[model samples]
Target: MSGQRKNPQARDRTIGAQLKALRQEQTTLNLEAAARAIGWSTATLSRIENGKRHITSEDVAMVLTTYGVPMAQREELIESARTGVQAGWWSRPLPGVLPDVGTLASYEASARAITDWSFSFIPGLLQTERYAAGLMSEDGAEPLEVTMRWRARLQRQRVLPTIDYTAFLHESALQQPFGGVDALREQLSHLVQASTRGLGVRIVRGRVPHRLLLHPWLLLDFPDAPPVLNVELNGSSVFLHDDEVRSYDNMRSMLDGMALSSAESRSMIGQLRERL
Candidate 1:
């Protein structure tokens, strides 16, 4: 395990666990107490505990010593801090992406399966370049920023081969003229093709009469770490971990139950395109 690299999600989870355990067990040092003793803020420590920020070996050493952890535990955590954080490619230089979106990219890179439910426009991973640009621009992101985000989204699509992806696109999403009629047609045609190539592009064929989770979200299942839910908001996103993710799981089962088969989904897309 020394040289073996874990997925970003698994690595972060392991590192966060080690740090959290050290803080909890070495006396009753709660988050605020430990943060003050280590000369950091509670928010910063909370990020560390939640695995939202990457910590260095020195950071690990300093926190452990402040908590009076044993030498052996300190060394183990320091070693983990050294190799546990995998680099995030989308995070480089930070031009077109929101901070939380970069976090989404990292999770997608390491997921074993992605079960998505979209009530609005198309899911990012399945979107074409023009469709993505249109949506981003319509949302008021700058032109160059739209290109950067679109390219990054295409890069994410390239990772589709490595995971099992099931996107449950509501029927209304197919009706969106995202980049005008031409772009929407092209995008739907692309989806039809993608379905044949290991992508489970299913259609939930009608308006959802009742809404429980009104927005779009996805469940990213890591090969090692437990599943997490990725929910996109108006300007930000949040990850629902552990038991909080179960609601999305239930939602997924419900959607799948309501979904059309892959073949039928492709047929539905074709039928919609003909009316355009």
Candidate 2:
């Protein structure tokens, strides 16, 4: 039980177990029968019950309604699903890291495509090792911990070659040196190299008039799943779903249209490197 408590996936599975129990108490329906009644696949139902997938409100409603749950019981199950979706191991704290780091890591690992807009700093996936280390060090992290964090960050970059990564970076982020001239140079060079390797890189020139019209945000898209939007503040992160993603999608397109083309972006970055 203790071991299960320590694993987020296991904890989610337990919620699925509860949902399964509710269904069982309501009827003698077998998995196939119940799944067919709800218009879902047996495999999907099985995955939900096994805690392999997150149960949404729609899923809860379908299952409870299919089992002929009473209004009162139905409301209870709906609320349970709401609470269950929010429960995850990343909500806990780890020494020298933000509470939301685990959750962020999990989402990134599962994401099929990532689109982000940055104004102040370079996106983590695009940061070079030295640039990442220098930025982490400036945050007051100890050397050893910064090294570990950099390693973890670098590992996350492995997803780039295999996944679709579209980054819309504000021109100011390119102009402002994060870790000194040399570090920024390497970072820009790295960005150009990555673009050559097939990553979608767009630069939103700061000189563009009316550029401050929209707020900075990050948008993530998953395969066969709903998109998620994220905004990071000084010490915390906020995750948004569904309608919010739709809004960001519009904003992302606007930014993309305003950005320099891939070739032009590389040339701009190269010019910046020359200035250094």
lDDT of each: 0.79, 0.71
**CA error at residue 20 for candidate 1, angstroms:** 4.5
**True-vs-predicted CA distance for residue 6, candidate 1, Å:** 20
> Clashing residue pairs in candidate 1, if any?
none
Prediction 1 TM-score vs. true: 0.80
Q: Could you tell me which 10 consecutive residues in candidate 1 have the lowest summed lDDT?
A: 1-10
lDDT of 1 at 224: 61
Candidate 2: regions farther than 4 A off:
1-95, 207-216
The deviation in Å at residue 254 for candidate 2 is 0.6
lDDT of 1 by residue, 104-208 (tens): 777788789998888778999899988888888888889889887877777778779989999999888888988789999998988988898869999986567
Tens-place lDDT digits, model 2, residues 172-221: 88876767788999999998998898898888875643543344566777
| TM-score: model 2 vs. ground truth | 0.67
- lDDT, model 2: 0.71
